[model samples]
Target chain A: MKKTLAAIALASAMMAFGLPAQAAEPIDPIEPVEVKNPALVELGKMLFFEPRLSRSGFISCNSCHNLATGGVDNLVTSIGDRWAQGPINSPTVLNSFGQIAQFWDGRAKTLAEQAAGPIANPLEMASTHEMAVKVISSIPGYGEYFKKAFGDSKVDIQRITDAMAEFERTLVTPNARFDKWLKGDKDALTAQELKGYNLFKSSGCTICHNGAQVGGQSFQKMGLVRPYQTTNTAEGVKAVSGRDQDRMSFKTPMLRNVELTYPYFHDGAVWTLEEAVAIMGDVQLGRRYMKEELADISAFLKTLTGDQPKIEYPVLPPSGPETPKFNPWAPAAK
Target chain B: MKKTLAAIALASAMMAFGLPAQAAEPIDPIEPVEVKNPALVELGKMLFFEPRLSRSGFISCNSCHNLATGGVDNLVTSIGDRWAQGPINSPTVLNSFGQIAQFWDGRAKTLAEQAAGPIANPLEMASTHEMAVKVISSIPGYGEYFKKAFGDSKVDIQRITDAMAEFERTLVTPNARFDKWLKGDKDALTAQELKGYNLFKSSGCTICHNGAQVGGQSFQKMGLVRPYQTTNTAEGVKAVSGRDQDRMSFKTPMLRNVELTYPYFHDGAVWTLEEAVAIMGDVQLGRRYMKEELADISAFLKTLTGDQPKIEYPVLPPSGPETPKFNPWAPAAK
Candidate 1:
């Protein structure tokens, strides 16, 4: 009995460290990815918090990707221009730097492209590129900052996109329990969670969900192994790329903070992480997880959450003589 | 010339009193509408600012309708539910009580309906009605308050909606330069603005834009006289209501803070208020205005802005055992 207990403890410890209880391939340590431009990231942080970039003169990027939360407003879809329903689910920006593409349809190839899309998207920033330039240029401090940041006082789309992308890149989730376990923490997971992790790998989830980003490196057919009904599939890449086969294929999302970023799935169909895990297993993995397995998997997935990145508000530039308190309806002095 | 000036002064003074400046009949003032329960409004205010209502355990209504900037985020659309675009513009909650209906599509018939929409919206609060009740009820202070407000500790949807609606009703835009002039402040508007106001009425803008809310009481074809092409028109309305007549017909929109609400129109096609006014005259009113007239009208519209409403955050209730800081992905204890 003493020898059996010792063996069980050894197996448990090994499993907690992301090692197989029996002999198997050892997992590698996750390398910390460094952000390229700290200054641009700092600048982007300020810009993200600045409401002046919006037409309403009140909303900032933080309004949606609220830092205090899991970097998402927990709504089915966001409200925007004229209080209409946005076409897609808002993805968390926490581990977005790991994403190969941005947006549900993956219309943007780079973070810079993604950054510019929202600033000029009528439903998002509601400001035209010309208006954004004009608004930024009107602020003397911003003009100077632009010159210092991008070698020009002339505010343009490229600098704005670069700055925002730089800021977003810094929004990485910190070391999660899973990462700690991978780094050899022997108490990071439990026996049941270890079983769930094994199931996750054997179930073929690792086929698409392997990488530092976990799942953002590629696109896959959501219902490849099984059939699932989705309205978005009908309106797929045709609406964006005007192509076929791109049909039913979406950018695989990063699962870094998946526990907090719900309702899950592209259309926000699954509200609970357990339901999502179960559905993905059934529909994508071609198997149905048992109740115990589902619960354990959910517990394991929860270990993926990490500390949120801290962001500071930007100091607004002095309003030009033409601007009045930045009030949209303030009557121009006759 | 003296007699002509006297007549002009008399006409301007009449206009100040919310009366028509020209031959149009004077319209009645929209009566002050009363909320169903004033105490509920007080409660709603508390709930609105409390981050505990959110799934991630942070973010309140004030997170978007920031009181510091005219009760709007100033973004064309707010980010929510994982940083996705909110479908419509975040209309300033200021003076929203005067709106005939809530939301750009007139989806919510009352403030209560509007209040409930966001809380349940997957992208906004990402909470269900039951979840909201459970969370609120878990708070001891909220239980007592709900009992006091609704005669029950078991808070229901109606009570929550009523409280929020009551709070929203109090968010009226106070006196602005326009209001002061209406109260007989002779110098409230300049000569150019007065001319612009005259043009505003004479050009028949008063036909659709006349009301306490300035324009919320009606919905008219975007281009009544001349057809204006908008890429988002057909699909936009279709997304909200499947009705065909609803095509190109959006909420007339309140022009109270027109100057602050930028990238004008439903699709945010017009970048500036001046351009919007110009387009309205050409397409809706079927008349053309000179650059000078557009400038003056734009100036007159500015006077409609009022002081920002004061908002106080509520003290959190301490009843429920503080759920360990909502770490959705934290590993379970061994």
Candidate 2:
């Protein structure tokens, strides 16, 4: 009885400290997939930096997916269409290629398809594919680059889409401290970070963010154990699926670089990783974490941030002979 | 005329390389205000740690205002009662005391008043002030400490509110590199940061965020120039003030420690600081910023983040002989 009590106490201590139990096996690390079309990726980078594609002639993909501050723009939702608030959260492009689908609604099937949606969405880029093609084709430099990248100077909408998509593919975050630890470099993470990782898995975050991408494979309701009823308009899959059950069922976003992405969840509701984790335990898993454990989990999440890729804004595209007149979107130019 | 053009060219070249044309005037830096009552701050820190304050007895202020990643809980909006989404964006508490008012709507008159609102609001803490007082009174250690701090053995709602407010006041962020530069430490910021600062002032951000707090004194319409009309019901100040002129007039929030706060603005609308600055120029100021200028501004904003404060979570209060029942809307709670 004494020995059993001692063992139980030890286990309890481990749980309090957020350590994994001795019985569980360690997870094996998976290698990242090599990206194809490096040159296309380079072209995509130029396109991401170009604001001419936007109807406002002021925004671009990098406008929201900033490389300097993680991969996310750090806002809960992106301001687009003359500073109109977007309905859903903007997930980071970092490691997003590993996601099964794109967008909070999972409406787009691939990165290329996803690129097209935002460009044409009334609230986002507010530009049609044809308009985007026309804008890019009109730029002499872009025309030459398109021919070099796609082996055709046709400068069609599909090639532009392909180049932007290819650029997003190369925006993957690589080898975070956690990734290094998973690859058998035990010293990569602090003891607290490791403990947080264990608690993250045992507490059931792994249920959604388990794969190599850490998430982005499925859709889950915001509230699992308890019903999350809000007067806020139904978002996520419900907008696309039109099913009652799909209400508040947002895409399971990738957790890579999550520590850098403030205001977590579909609505950007949660503010800290610790708070989000604690709330998840209560609403999703029906459990509560000790303060120390929550702290550990937060520390672990910070290790996911990798170095931001360096990007240079492309030279402004010169107005072409056949370029559409720059009609000011505002009522009257000052 | 030739000499003037030559000077202009030189200045333009310097700006392109991310440098300022002139040295900045030095200014004295203000020290952070210290909390009045240490014991009360200590007690409030404990309350912040204790999840029992929530309706579910599983969430706390630390759940959202996590110290690890600035002060935000990192969700776009916080999850509260039954995991309901909060209406407004979560601002960082790092230098929140510098603000003119609390909440995005500027509804609360003081931090003490703001502290009580969340505890009883159905969508947030959901705990009545009476219940909160009773719970604290029941704790022996807390009861004793309350008497020492307020000269009463029993814990009243005002004392509870005051204690929490006192604790929150101590959450001041340390001075940033920008502050150091303003104090005449020339090497405090990089050349890019200095250029960004120039663009920030010339681009009209200084029109609102001037003075020591950077902002927090007024409210402004989001689309002052462009008039961003949207059918969405979340039209900021209009929802609070119910006046036509108040449409989308959100409180001018402080820019202190802004780089740490993601999802800028009251609605958490713009994601990156650069994107936010870009939108401010295009929609609010009726101007556009060059790409290099925007980059420089973003670099300068990063200098606003201060060193993290040193804080420790409080201990749980001990149980007492008598306990009062929960009452959310009591005058004392107010």
Candidate 3:
């Protein structure tokens, strides 16, 4: 009976240390996207880069969520309509659909829903759904695109967001070095990086940071073990739920392409990956990692960098005479 | 002697009426671009779309001179740094290389020279050449590009502008209906359009508006036959040449994609092509064109809309720790 107890104790200890768990892990590799409708995607690409959708006719979906720089504008926070500074860091749109819900507060349930919020936001694009539709519909060239994409020439807010969401779903980045390692490539990661991965798992970082996107699978409190200090006024999930307990709870930001999307965290208070990791360890895990351990973990995080989307900048159709002129300061079109 | 004099008068009348002059006309079709160095062009394209060159890190060259919409921002005058209004209209970059010089005032003799002006202009990009170079050099990914393009990894203002110029040279748009007609396609222009073309030549509009680019060949007075009224303070070539005679003298604007580039003239006062044509006739040619004549001439101008360049939006590299942060309010970097 003592031997049986000892055997159980050894098994539990091994699991805690992440020993012999390398073969089956919590993290999964990102899968390549399979596009079903090419025409819809093509139309969506045009709309994604169409700045005419903005009130100033200068901003677009790509303005904040730039595909060129790891699906982010790489700003600490975004600059919006007439250069109004955004409240929080613009999150990377890469593999964003893998998240259970959209936005840091999980307010948006789908990519399409998320796409609708920014277009009419006074601080962002500052254009209404009706105005956006009117501008697109008024253009003679977009008629053929609408017809080809939605089986009609009619332009609507629903079809617009649907197309954008479909295009965004195709923006998944697969086959990072970490993904290659997960897929059984023995030499994909360096010895130091592999050690860092094991440490990351054993230290319980993967509790909320797992799955294909690494961190977007769950919402977690910002400061679990210790209190966090920040000047940013955001109340996280409490802003949406109106619950005191949900005050500091936020959707875990995905780690994919985190290397390119810098000035880390919701407030974008942290600039370096090392500092971010150190803060995470102290406030979330109650761990004081050694210098080398922090470096190793940061190295592991860097391995999440993946291929970016190759998008041909679509030449948008010229505006027709009926298309409303861009009015940066005007109220939303009724 | 009487018969010989009558024959000369008939020849002069036929030339003035644009009869028997179809075979050898003033206009020439735009030639296709010949790209000699693909690497240089690729590097140039990346730089062209790079907003990091701006002090705000939000406005690239493509922001004002947008390739998606006839190479111009389509604004009356460009909205620049911190929403500063520009002095003059932004011209389309399409087929601009065919011009004798760059800018309305012809201040810059070459596209390479013109490329350097906006980067440090306080109201425009508001970034110094040194700062722009530093930002590009700090990015590790741009090193390979510089090396491939210039046979060295050294980033400088000259090489940067040169690469941009190389890319700009390839922005030529060919294969318009007018170009097809010039190349001997009989059905390229309809009956009304053909009649308009003849009237356009016979009315002496082709005196200044000629060549492959239609109008970029000469610096002509804005109101040659009458005093033009405008609230715009731009003195045109007088601002550059500082001569009283050069006042209101500007480069004859290109008409290649005139259909897409609306809000005509240096002040961008005229929104309709028909109104612009009527104004041009009254002010520049000293002739009052009838309503149907203006409509016909506008129809002829619409045929000049060529194929826009199909540019794949370049994926820019991530900024490094050493790269300078964007400061919209800051003075130029030393």
Cα lDDT tens digits for candidate 2, B1-334: 2332353455568658866433332222435776667778777666665545665443466545655446764345665654456676677766666577887777777778877877887777777887777676665666567776777776677777777777778877557888887765779989888777766765568788866667777788878899754433566667778888887887787777676566666666555777888887788888787787788888887787776666632334322334332212233333
Which tens-of-lDDT digit does each residue in B201-315 have in candidate 3?
7778889889889999999999999988899999989989889999999999999999888778999888888999999999998988889889888999999999899898888
Model 1 lDDT tens row, A1-334: 2332454566568768966532442222234458665666666776776666765554456655655446665445554443335556667777787677887777888888887776666566555667666777776657666666666776777787788778777777767877777766758878766666666666677678767777877877777778767664334444577777666677787777777777667776666777888889888888878787788777777777776664433434434544423343333334
Here the TM-score of candidate 2's chain B is: 0.84
State the lDDT of candidate 3 residue by residue for A1-334, as single tens digits.
2332453455458668866534567789998688998889988888888888888888899889888788887777788888777888889888998899998889999998999888989788888899899988888999999899989989999889988988899898888999998876768999777777777777888898999899887788999999888988889999999999998898999998888888788988787788899999999999887788788888989899987877877888988889877645455457
Best-to-worst TM-score order: 3, 1, 2
Per-candidate TM-scores read: 0.53, 0.48, 0.92
Local distance difference test, candidate 3: 0.85
Q: Interface RMSD for candidate number 3? A: 1.9
* Interface quality of candidate 3 as DockQ: 0.52
DockQ value of candidate 2? 0.02
Compare the candidates by TM-score and give the number of the best one.
3
| Candidate 2 chain A least-lDDT 10 residues | A21-30
- What DockQ does every candidate get? 0.04, 0.02, 0.52
Off by over 4 Å in 3: A1-23, A327-334, B1-23, B327-334
